[model samples]
Target chain A: MEFTLIKPLFGGFLLGLAALSLLFFNGRVAGVSGILGGFLSFKKHDTLWRFAFLAGLVTGGVLLLGTFPETLNFTLKSSPPAVMLAGLLVGIGTRIGSGCTSGHGVCGIGRLSQRSMIAVVVFLSSGIAAAVSIDLIFGGEI
Target chain B: MGLLMIFLSGVLFALGLGISGMTQPEKIVSFLNVVGEWDPSLIFVMLGASMTYLTGYGFILKRSKPILAESFSLPTRRDIDPPLVFGSLLFGLGWGLVGFCPGPALVALVTGYDSVLIFVLAMGFGMYFFEGIDSRFQRGVDGGAA
Candidate 1:
């Protein structure tokens, strides 16, 4: 394991803290898809909080980057275009499911919601299948 | 009360990603690749997450009383269904293709990967795809889940 338990522990810990804070003030869950999805709204009035949240997200990453320069290696063996297309499809899936895996898998699961559980299961199984199929059909073999 | 707990959860989850190496797209890509120059980052991440999970969930559970709230809500459904199967398939397909999912994808934006924009746009469409005039209600539902 190139990574360690402390990483996830701290990461999850931060996520939980973020969730708690949102709940305290906004009575909200910190699902990124929903927050990011809301940013397109033209109503400047309604978007302020969403914008703020999204801003915080970006800011958090920026802070991390500044703190940990070693964390920013951006090389992938696959083509960028291919990955982008994949991301496009994922966006569609997140839309169809009414939530992303994190919304469902992490926060939803953390809260123990039926929908989130179902969503997580679907996300995990589908990801595993996709991994297998990609290896089999394309010989990409991940 | 609920809002407070949720916010705390988000911070914790993000922290997990940051620490687990899941927040790192390269690690994720390597994990997905698994065959050629496979990156062992995934193992470390899972281990990192599992170790954290050991105390994390239990600690929350033991609290019996969550901060700012009476209790924590657990997942309602126990069965796997069609949506579960199909959605998982789609999500997986997308992840394999992009090497990015919701969690890592958002965090990865710090790197300014141009592809993150495309992914985020598609994700927006995905979130709104289910509703029409009742969209407000749906957004709330979606928002609540997040």
Candidate 2:
């Protein structure tokens, strides 16, 4: 019920627009893992757009930093090993799952894909479970 | 033209992540803390994105092809498989663990922090490793059962 939620709401709208733009223009799904993974492992002919997209993301970051530096005020809470393991898991898991939050939660759900729905459910469940378990065992926000 | 559009899309996506607080790992971690002081802002994020995209998708599907492409490249698989379930579960676990999915992690890479840099490198390695293993399994190089 807090007004702070407005920021995420507005940002979410932009994220959706971003996905819609890709769908409308390129006939592609704007899945971050898919884009980056393909860029890392796919053939050369399809790499250009992926590269350009990532470059654009970096450019956006620069623009945001220059305009509103206060948006990025949080810090990493996990340790080095935890971070590495999580990254590895996320990279492989997203590739195997065929999507992530953006792909499944936003685009897939918006398009009414059953597979994406199931994937989103699984993602939320596991995410909450891991978070709770970590908190219970680690006894803090790790 | 298509490439430029994709670039712009990425820009928008990153800006959205930044604005929505999705780029902040701790914010996400807080959201995951459902038993504690749960932050429901991420819920609004998904809601806002879903509504926006759903409306656009409704209109976009009316067309045969996209503006710059011949066909809509969408996921066609409808069946539920072990990989899909387990993979999503694993991805969610990782997301909970690190609070950095592929997109925000990329955005966070701009911070030039050692943690973000290391995570990105490891993630890249993980993706490459999956490709290597999957391809070998496809070709029966390591006797990997299909």
Candidate 3:
């Protein structure tokens, strides 16, 4: 497809705004992995905010689908097994790394955290390398 | 009131992911594929989010505590451990394989993509499994310290 700039840029602005809102009001970093992982270590008082945040996340997508379906593209290129394996790896890895794209990439980078900075560089580099390797193996199918 | 603000934040985050094309794996994969056709649009997403956070956090941190919460829950450890490096490497591999991170994957699941359910399930399992191992490791470390 053709390269388009506006949509992604605008979306980024919203993403930034979201992170800011979380920090400003809740004093919490808007990292998805951390939000989801907190339930595993469930504390009594901790459950409500996490659940609410997750519910809102799902609700947001549902609302967008109902209103502006064109805004999202639900395309899948990986097989079921591959996707599942990927999910498992992501889950374990993010927990071990202590953040995902949102945690490390967005919030971590925003705070200028040295640990986050290192994690971002390592993950981004590895991600790029893996993508290249996958492209080679799949013969550019992905 | 706290919960409501959090819920609203999640909605905003989800909308941003959807609008930024972060929900789409193909776009993510394209952005990652540096040697091949590279899509640099995601940089704007990172830039926008980071800039906003940079500014917002500046003001937010100046306060002694959050308006809604008792304190800010921020990552304090600065050390770069082995787990961080290896875990990040694995995370990258998986991200490249499916182009679905925790955030976008959840968003996609909500949008009626049944296939993403498998990924979510597997991810949950992965998280639990890691937790089990991590707790055990922590126990061993604590014992040694004692």
- Compared with the true structure, the alpha-carbon lDDT of candidate 1 equals 0.57
DockQ for model 3?
Answer: 0.60
In angstroms, the error of model 1 at A16 is 1.6
Candidate 1 steric clashes? 67
Better structure of 1 and 2 per DockQ: 2
How well does candidate 2 reproduce the true complex, by DockQ? 0.60
Cα lDDT tens digits, model 2, B1-146, are 77888899999999999999888877787788688678888899989998899999979878999998889877767777777788789889989997888888888777878898889988899888877887777731110100
What RMSD does model 3 have? 3.5
Task: Write down the TM-score of every candidate.
Answer: 0.71, 0.94, 0.93
Superposed by TM-score, candidate 3 places the C-alpha of residue B63 at a distance from the truth, in angstroms, of: 1.4
Query: If both were scored by DockQ, which would come out higher, candidate 1 or candidate 3?
Result: 3
A6-85, model 3: which lDDT tens digit per residue?
87778777888888787777778888887887776676888788888888889888877776676566577777888888
Instruction: Give the per-residue Cα lDDT of candidate 1 at A135.
Output: 63
DockQ of every predicted complex = 0.35, 0.60, 0.60
lDDT of 2 at B39: 84
| Winner of 1 and 3 under TM-score | 3
